[model samples]
Target: MSPGADAPDTGRFALRGRIVTLDPADTVLDDGVLYVSGTLIEAVLPATAPAPPGFAGVTPLDTRGSVYPGLIELHNHLPYDVLPLWQVPKRYGNRSQWGGSGNPAYRTLVTGPMKVLGQDPRLMPAVVRYVEAKALVNGTTTSQGIALFSNAGARRMYRGVVRNVEQTDTPDLPEAASRIADVEAKDAEKFLARLKQPHRLLLHLAEGTDAAARAHFQALQFQPGKWAITENLVGIHCTGLNADDFTVFAAHGGSMVWSPLSNLLLYGKTADIAAAKEAGVLMGLGSDWSVSGSKGLLGELKAARLASTAAGSVFSDRELVAMVTRDAARILRWESALGSLGAGMRADLVVVAGTHGDPYTSLVDARDEDIRLVAVDGVARYGSGRLMRALAPGENLEPVPGTAGEHVLRLDDGTADTIVAGLSLGEATERLAGALADLPALAATPVPPITASPGGGVRWQLALDEIEPTGAELRPRLPLLSASGETHPTGPGIGALTAAPAELEPVALDALTASDDPVFLATLAGEGNLPADYAGALARLLT
Candidate 1:
């Protein structure tokens, strides 16, 4: 271990305060003093401990107020910048009453919004600023985001669209398509690349079925130790994978992010949780796009606890917190830098007023408002007011805007505790929903079907009468009405049905050979054609 590069440098600083230090073990230090230097934890001494000699330059932090390590969001999407309150159904007239106040346009306007947002850089910055503002206030310092259309897809789409346009005689149509593709490619690449520089990046590479899922993984060549090297890339919500997929992911010793709520909402099912655990894969949980239900990761944890309990799972509440904290740090490969309140780790911490009543129970049941202060890399992001006031002298106290005095929270026992800060239940729900409302739509307008090959077999090519953008999941049912007015029960694969003229051969071969089960092949007359490799992949599956 080359002294873990992320370790703190040599120096001595005392953090004497109520510290919820998630260290080698979960420990709450009352009037505790932690001495650190050069990025490593030197010692966790009592506040009464004498200051080490020759440590004169050390800044004594009067944390008698609050301090803790930075928080970790194991599974998040970085480049997929969702606006706060933008993609809601309120913007669309066709949306129904059942759509609820949540962002209903998410499924409808995914393509247009993705295309437009993808074209602009400021869009991401603006969204991130808002989200970061909210996250800091809530004590979330590090997050793993699995952004949409990774760099690879963006590059391919760019080349494909450019080629498609250059070969076309129609200037306006070609230029439009080319521009859209160009924007998507550039935006995705730039954001993903930028996210990679951060300490924690989980960029999601989610695909629908096993085959498509495998396609994305295969694109990476499943190399071992890749994620560890970069210390980024947390694979979230992966499903329908074969044993080989697990082997590859495990080889890198990367973290697995399971978003049960988001998965259930979008797809009918979620990943094989039990299977993931059996493979010794480090696990973490995320709330995902829980705003639709007016929830966050804490709510996600409760849901996970119930689901796991129903399944007879043995993971404890401490284990659960690890998913959001310690385990999450492992996923980001930032264990040395975050996840615990060791001496070397940044003094980024959180204080929940006071520690009493089953710690685990309190954490699970507590609302986001329970959080006191949030620090990032030794700097206070939120809840700095009370901490600063407690540490500095009264005469030295200057006018602080957001730094209000400590709040007195009344408990059920008719007693009250004066705490510096906390999150409100109502506010948390409102803020999360408001944030979700900004997400791009995933649904698209249904178009007329264009038939391609109605050959001898049950094969019939079907194309969307128009171009429609797809999301993480693509499920389209083509109505195959026969001459007698009876509809055929058969529906072809999306790739096969939408295959353009150039893609016909491969799509046909794939449908014919991809699976042991018989496949019905079809193609839409004029959509972007499929390629030969796709047919080859399908052929391998069949064989």
Candidate 2:
């Protein structure tokens, strides 16, 4: 969309209506507006701003509803099958006999036993894939999966989880530790490698206990930024792992996918929240699945918030929102694209209605039906029933499928050309960095040319552009750059919008033409988080 009269073509997008951008500092726009172009975020101004100039020719998408970044499910998967609780009891009739109790309380107890008793390993992967698909439609764009174990004899710790499967050590108790390490080793390797291609992978390396967790790390010869360690490799449900495992995860600088309810429901525990925090690991909360927990993140948030506080310190409502938004995006390593409402990122966004007092608490307590609209890259994917019906009577727009937008930018999807076609310089640069970063092999190598516009015309753009937090009403400044090598800085801000390829000066130029308030440019080459004298330092470099 073009900027309205009297406003500069800042290249940012405006979703209109209620816009929710999950930056770490928890900045939201009520009756919000977003400014996106190419793949960088130009600005996220309030709706009060007059439509920027040049918008006359641009097609305006009147969301007139809420908008949000695409939702991401960190510790989830594509399930092959989602059997009913009752189905499990009959399918593997003797599963309950392992505990010698057909009692419903031990339904979880039967999971390990059923699988350990020679269920084909090949089926597990497909079953997981099904669950992954379900999550996608539930506002989940990304999911995580752990290595699946085969039988009771696969891993010692896994046997311990379902000792009743083959109760050699305890009577009527599932064996938590089995000799399935060999099987798990193979299965884990396959699952991890599978996650590398196409699907965003979050490996749940549950090694039973802390001691075993450490040992697995050593065995895997894990190294930072090696062996398909894409930015999206999140560690999930890692309670049994010790400090060493945390260190290994930290050294890699990956995120942690926490499933508090599922953890408590199935294993009576969740990941070590305190340890995860101390390690600087980005923390993303999950709902697991209805099989083990509720599909709603609201419930997941309540469980994790309470659990995290008891296990550590109290977490504010904003913190809970972060777990689902900014922090979650960070863990996915998709902070540049999917998590926020900055310029150049996907226009995928969500909006809620009637939120007046507190956005975070309201969002945490938000119901599924409360979602007004969900867009995928600037287009509405899910429109509220009331809004859609009101907009076009007798028109029934299909809601977004769970996995509908997985690869929307691909050439075959008919949306290839439109990808990032309208982003600003800041967003464009960020998109460049994100796309290039995916291939660590190439990203690490030297490249030629430092031209700002690699896509030829300013309209041409690249993919990988689609994809933070706090609260307490903090004020921060973000810089804005214009087409004419000018920079305009805003007031106090939590994050900056910069350029990529380490050579373009678009952001600096943006600051020269931006508003009087302090503004900061974000860049790939730039160091992470510089609070003191940032705008001045950045200003000097860009100018």
Candidate 3:
């Protein structure tokens, strides 16, 4: 949906909290009040400051927590949510060495399962929803990855998806022109020319700890007869690049995306972050994929801290936070629209319990449960059940089972509707373990061998049926409300709500249930929560 649609005419509301604005000045307000007008942030001021002259009747949403801009995940593969960590018998020098053609375990476990799942169009949306929920619960509001679902409707699930650069033969300038075949070089040239356009160019380059991996950066730099690197270039996992390589990249206005968890898992080492930073390369953080990475960007942030410390480079908590927020947005060329909490910018934000003296430190230490609210464009999409009701009273709120106080709010774009709540990080992952249980292709596919004898080789076997549901059983259980506006025990079916809230009258239960609008009432029940005062304000809101 276009961000403007269903843009809650929040007429005017002041989100009061401890604000951490990752602005150019790194402004932090101990007790801040952010006034939001529709989808834009109208003003950010101190809690004691009076409301601006024009916003007289604005409702105050007391977040009572630490508020900050939503995080940006610069790189990820959403579809890879289906795969668990699959270790091979031996390590390889680079991704190509293992992923290209050498490893039987990769083929049998990673590639084989993906190919099988890709054949079924029916399962793609489910996988997409799973991954999007995984990111949202972790406080990530923006994510960029290769498009997996063709449905435009899926785009409404998140705040934004970075537009993908068209794939060409060079996919991502693999190696220097001379090192690659003639046909590949021609493809790389074609790809490089398109970089002149205004879109962010992303590619996985030098992602290993070997000479060949480091050489990829050289190939990109001297590409023989191609255009030079530009600011649009975003290199992912530069595990092999050295200090000199980073200098060359920074000189050409290139940025790097750090996926330390994945790098450490696959290559036993990560990028020379100290070198990259010293060379003035803009850095962003990403949660590569579940296969070899942390659960999401939150976990990845911790990994980045550990990696930075081990490398003898100390990045303050605020700097680390910027890597996922402001710096990441700059890398994607979205600085004008996102990255910081400011007036005239979209209200994509995250609210967590304020437990530390420093907001940035609190953010780095936050868990999924600590996330009190996550909003995109002024609309609260996920948060505590009470918070969701207070923010968007008329909209439907679905309980995110397995989470102590979490819930998902439904969003309706004029064309379609999508949900934004998810299982807690751990619960979401547990659900993924059995995602392939019903896919027959997994069982039908043949397993390749790492050794000569069948018994000595690793096999592609999963006890799918043994996996249990990770969260609460989701059955359509709608609470029945009496004519007096009191919530009653949930009944067997939605048949109890025969009349829409707008049509209900002050009468006995029998008369209320016999009124017209059963269809509309049933629809509300399916979506979930219906407040006690829903019949009064919500009736007008829904109509």
Candidate 4:
């Protein structure tokens, strides 16, 4: 699913608010009228301008807030987000060091639980439904896709209410490729060719902060002078790259996705984003996964802000906002159709309450409670209950808890992944909570085998990307020569992938909204790997 796409719900609505149009001129039009007609933005006119003939008798929904382009998450591990934060034992230099069996808890804490959850049909959709809601509630409109496969070897990317970058059938929204086939990846030239096939190829690259991690990037030098990367390659977590390396990457027109929190939690440092910026490399934000990263993309924005502050403020609030919106869209070659507020662009935006202060800062500093409405394809999906009742009146909606007031979720269950389409949010959350509460029992329980046929025959299961033999490896599998002259793989090892279950322990389902989960902030405060200042600064921002 390179990882991320979306479609039209035929509806017309007039949204008047402060529009932060991430256009060429960077216009912030106050008291603007954003007219939406059938999933497209009909017009974005100034309030003083005469209404277009199209605004006949429509009642405008005045979002007493600021409207910015929807948050586009370039990277995430969706299914794994169901697990709570893993208190990483200690800071390691690279992924291989910590992800290996040296840590005894690896089997029990991460991989083991996932092995059980990924296979059981009874629980997989619950995982999908819950994680997607976790993202939507936080103002995410498009992100990486969740890959699911049936027992018959048929594969399909999970398409829910949120736009999946990998499977959009729409003409304007071109699909991206995340995972390279094993055959193509193993051969360097084929990998290069595969990259040229799609609009983007989002591969996990140079994740750790050590020489071993740097070697992964070096291996992309398939030849002495020529590198395998291209304009289409969107590398995730380039922590291993140095200034010179980023310069080389920029020369090739390559972009990167940064997961600073995940990098800091595991490797004690993140990507040299300052070098990336100086080298003129485009960058986007990724929440990695909830186990050691943020609960949602909005949380990642704050983390990026703090990191930028420590780096002598290499990026301003507006620049940081661009990374998630316009720059991100450009990276995916989607700037024309999405990423900004303009006439004829898709009607995709998020509203945060209050137009006070810097709109960019307000958005970056915003908590979940501040997000009043998040619309995709001109349709309201998640918002405050009052707004939902008014805008999305005909749709069946779900109630969600919030710190300030009750929020509501309106998802069209009729998505590409039919297995999850029938399950409601309440039912999905209840099942996930109960199943996770007793992991050992759930693991011990037998899973019904999926049949091969289509009509009443096949059922979808979660395709764990990290799990071997199921799908493409999450990380780039650029082979490197060991000191002994043997080839070593940069991605997960076979033993690591086939980890046997340790005695499973009960785990609580991760909280849906950060505003509702105080433990998220509390745990980060106590977390030894994060900066001492991060928790407090984050508290000030979110609270």
Candidate 5:
């Protein structure tokens, strides 16, 4: 924004920081310059290098922190993230045992409520606005898209400030599928054939600690030694898989996404990550959802570190950080364009509060308050007030709550979905919290336009994947035998919401960022499934 800046129309600017480029050699420049032009990174050079052509007159931003690629969350149910953490009722053996249909606690606490929220046209925009903002505060640039349904049951992806892996209109950013066609899912042969067509398909696999959960994976071997997994099949939470199972997964070019906290909270244990590592399986970390999981990938990283230590320091800070950065991009088949800071790549990166200590740990251990800036496609979306004023002036910035009011968010740019425009963060938080507090009222209320809706007049209600049927399932309940030798799916699928809620169960809205949640640390420590040492260590670190 300097006086002599050349061609501001190109949106050219320079950011200087301690860059941690996760290139092939893992390059780190103590004082680096990230030159950006429009939507792509022009070059990553040292501060001593001569300024790039168009950046000569533009004043460079001294981030005064360590810079890394924006965190890419491979797995998350974003809409459900508005709900607070679930107080697990008991240790369940498998996904089927505590099916969203059978368990009153899950049905009443999780699925039933989401069903109402996702179906309401008037409240749908609030769901999209709140969750996407939550992702921004936590430094996540890309995540799974929210699937919406029309009155006639037409499906569409929710477009928002956050880059959705499900749909990216541009060719460089290939669209990944979180939901496949119904035809592809019901048949094993069809699912395998879809994997061979060259695209990343994220599906939940073996999500429990019992034999029934393991059977979901075992059934993938349609015939002896012939598995349905391929590099394109990115399984979410292979908790039920054994060391040998990971060997097979890697052998078939498959990868895995781990949500340690969610697994530990539901079952008594999590995946045997050490075994997967031994088998050379590529793994990425996901926050899953706010209920029974970390608020975001930042908290997820801390939980991962704790779990890693309990497993005898199985992964270093560098490896754990990579899961959400470099490794995560690779899982989505986008290594060349994102998940790393490189020339000609997308300008998606984050700046944390420090330039000292282990750079990798700086990012892995950071909280929301410690984040200095988050830029996606070279546009500042969230950051400290000073940085936002400089990077995104006249963009109608809103103060991001849960950061002690220190950080601000700018979503009014062309980036935001039309449904989210003109909607303040405060309004979205209030309406969503109030709706969750009274589920019965929300379900019974008419869909007529209310004064609070910010969508102008567009009624946008996306079907919540895994809750309501949206063509295909996010987690495949592949065919397997039940304990009674009944042929059925080993894992649970979209369960029937048997009846309407009879009572008004008040549920607290989940905290926007982990750093601001008063009880977030305590809840992690109190989880009965986590080992005493792991729980204690996490508490002490956060405290």
Candidate 6:
């Protein structure tokens, strides 16, 4: 959904909770009451204040949690959810080496079987839907990535930030672009020109410590006289960037999206975030993909916090939260409607259980189990089964048990059924393991030998000169690059492609793969005070 456009008025209702409004000054209302009229926020008032005259009959949804703006994931590769924590034996010099013919795992696990599965039109959509559900369960209301599923003529199955239209064909120039290598000098000039208009250009720059990665940053830097606009640029990874590079990026108003966990796992190092912060370059958080990143944005937030702390330049809890909310929205140019909680803003909100006096602390420490509700456009799309029942009595709410014996609420939105259940930070990983266990045996392909030149160029060949051929036959599973000259798993590793055929039961498979539900304790409007035993109330609700 485009930012700020009023969604069709579903109806009016009130949500009362401890609100943490990410206003200019970071306001906190211990007992805040937000009135929603249709898709827009009608008012944000103290709970002690009287309700507006027109809201007399509307029921209030009382939550024992803190309500804030929905989290915005600025970067992600959603289809990679099928694979959990996949990596080679050792770090490669660059991303190309990791995915190229040089890596045996890439050839067998990803390129060979996975590629074959991805070609299946039926299976691809199921995989994409599962990834989206993972994001929603983690409290991500708005996420940006290459759209793999078509929602045309169907009710939007994946609720958060649906911008699926391919922008490459736009004559006026695309609103966003990615992958720095794809942009040549001419393309960069065109990108600069587009910056004059409303545009955002994202690139995977400085992703590794190798010279090739460093050169990518140089290619992205503005030439003294050739280019000038940098405000619309967003660089992802940036692990190899130095102080001078940070200075240049900040001077031009360029921002960066940090994937700390992915960076650390890939290169054993992350960006100089402290220097970037000091340079005044805005930073947003992202989970690169399931292969090298945490489960989702919530897990990524914890990783970012730990990384920052280890670097001796810790971000405040509020500042860390803003990185995924306001700061990210600003980068996406959706700040007006998506980031903060205020009257007239789009009602994209998240509620998480927290007992601390400081809401920021609770948010920082919140696991998926802490999240009680996540709403987009004034609709409660995901929450506990109990909350979903109260929010939309007309819709069917089914309880699906996760691997850990936790129940998740699964809802169907016409197009596809989505698991809106609360998941612990590690639940997705556990489910992914179970899903993979159902797969058939994957055939192994011989690893292609890679010869490196002194100039850092890699040459891949079927056989090396020093090695003698044995009686054993060798077969190359798939070409390193496809017919279109694109690498396998173009955006991210597609894991479901290689799974066993018998396990392709989409509905049943997803149900068995649902994550654990969170603890939820809420009172419907007009109810008396919360039960004295809050834990007991939550336990009863879960049962």
Tell me each candidate's TM-score.
0.51, 0.50, 0.71, 0.94, 0.92, 0.72
Candidate 1 has a TM-score of: 0.51
Q: How much lDDT does candidate 2 score?
A: 0.40
lDDT of 3 by residue, 45-117 (tens): 9878888767778766788799888888777765564555434344456665555333444444554455444
| C-alpha lDDT values of all predictions | 0.40, 0.40, 0.58, 0.81, 0.80, 0.58
User: After superposing candidate 3, which stretches have Cα over 4 Å from the reference?
Assistant: 1-11, 87-90, 145-191, 223-227, 409-413, 417-435, 438-543
Ranking by lDDT: 4, 5, 3, 6, 2, 1
Residue range with the least summed lDDT across 10 consecutive positions in model 6? 470-479
Position 383, candidate 1: lDDT? 48
Per-candidate Cα RMSD to the true structure, in Å, reads 19.3, 24.3, 20.4, 2.5, 4.4, 13.1
lDDT of 1 by residue, 479-530 (tens): 2234565444422222222322110010111110111112311111111222
Residue 80 error, candidate 3, Å: 1.0
- lDDT measured at residue 201 in model 3 versus the true structure, 0 to 100: 61
For 343-376, candidate 5 gives per-residue lDDT tens digits of 8998888899889999998887786788898887
Residue 359 displacement in candidate 6 (angstroms): 1.1
User: Highest lDDT, which number?
Assistant: 4
- Worst 10-residue lDDT window, candidate 2: 460-469
- Tens digits of per-residue lDDT, candidate 2, 202-224, equal 45554223343333343343233
Better of 2 and 3 by lDDT: 3
Candidate 6's TM-score: 0.72
| Pairs of colliding residues, candidate 4 | 2-177, 2-178, 3-145, 4-164, 4-165, 4-166, 5-164, 5-165
